[model samples]
Target: MSITVEKFVEEGRDPFSLEVVAGHEYLGRIIKEAALNRPGLALAGFFQHFAHLRVQVLGLAENAYLKSLTPDERGQRLHRLYQKKIPCVVLTRNRQPSSEILECAEAFKVPILKTPMITNRFINLATLLMENLTAPLVRYQGTMLEIMGIGVLMEGQAGIGKSETALALIERGHSLVSDDLTVLRKDSTGAIVGYADDMTRYHMEIRGLGIIHVPSLFGVASMRREMHLDLVVRLERFDPKKEYDRTGLNSETISILGADVPLLTIPVAAGRDIAHVVEVAALNQKLKQLGHDAAKELDEKLVRALERKRRM
Candidate 1:
């Protein structure tokens, strides 16, 4: 997916206050590439390998270089650089563009933006936002919640009580990221980050309860905007005939947006406290991350005891 320059300026948050200085009509230009480029070499009349498709950034050094040039020289260089039809240009540290550059921007119909953030800070923030905005995404029918700091995605068939389980977790001091439908995206580091849809964010549907706002009823502490999905818990109805894994040694995983997240299946019954079971599953996942696997340890101990008995 591509992000428009106009959307970037409008939706950009703290550390990236972008204001368009020129080319208002070109705000509709799409930023197809997530990576940014410093146009220092391009301004020096080098066009062999110019990354014209990426967002051009003018930092302290580039701005100072422009000021040192003669008016005619600066105008010529700016004109040549903008001729490449770059997506957009951003001036960092609230630096004012030279008249030649601004004129070139208007003449070439390229959008020029300015931000108060320093060079490196702005680049980092912009790149991050661009990457996230264009990242691969998948929507799952589940409820995402944070239990003991671990992101647990409760997934099952419709009307399987995903939202009710999340509500219970909230009552237990946990936080809800999304309910009903969770949008998962793979970040740059290959971790799956889950977020709520704009329309459904902080809203949960319960049987006979209708649509309810989670944060409004549970307070701000019970809701989160987004979270890195760490584990998936599948709630299945208890069945006497179905054989389930009795030991916790099952290394099950569910793939979402190309990231494999650990999965746990809990049998749900009339008296089963599924909320508490999911909470324990999340805590167990944390322990596994800390290099402790209780199931494996138990199996190893049993093997050792069997070997000793044979020796005796």
Candidate 2:
């Protein structure tokens, strides 16, 4: 998804308090790339392998260099840079462009944005926003919650009590990331992050009850905007004859968007407290992360005891 210069100025927050100084009519220009480029070399007449598609940033050094150039030189350089179909150019540290640069931007229809933040800060924030706006997204029918700081995705057939269990977890102080449908995406570091569909965010539908606003009912702390997906829990109907894992000896994983996430299947029975069980599962996952696996430790202990008995 391409973000236009207009949207970037409007939706981008805080340090990116951008204002269109020129090329207002070209605000609709699409930023097809998710990277930013500093025009230091370009300003110095070096456009050999220029990334013109990215948003151009003019920092303190670039601004000073431009000031050092003769009026004719500056005009020619700005014109050449803008002729590359640049999406937009940002002036950082609230620096205003010279008349020649503004004229070139206007003539070439390149949007010029001014922000109060330093060059590095603006670049970092803008890069983050662009990455999120263009990140690859996948959708799944499930609920996402933060369990002991671990993102748990609950998946199961309809009417299998996914939402009910999520509700229970929320009541126990766990925050709900998303209900019904979850939008998952990978960040720059390759961690899968889950968010709710805008329409259904913070809302859940229970069996006997209608749609309920989670934040309103449980207060703001009960809801979360997004979370990194760390675990997946599938709730299955109990089958007496079905063979299930008797011990937590083997770890299972499920692939989501090309990432292998830890998976757990809990059979649902009439009197099973799935909510409490899931809470324990989340805590156990935390313990495993800390290098203590209860199942593995027990197995090792048993092996050591058997070796001692054999020696005796």
Index of the highest-lDDT prediction: 2
lDDT of each: 0.88, 0.90
Looking at model 2, residue 99 earns an lDDT score of 96
Runs of candidate 1 with Cα error greater than 4 angstroms are 13-15
**Deviation from native of the Cα of residue 80 in model 2, angstroms:** 2.6
lDDT of 2 by residue, 176-217 (tens): 999979999988888999999988888999988899999999
Q: Which pairs of residues collide in model 2?
A: none
lDDT of 1 by residue, 117-203 (tens): 998988888888888878899899889998888999999998778888888999999999999899999999999999999988988
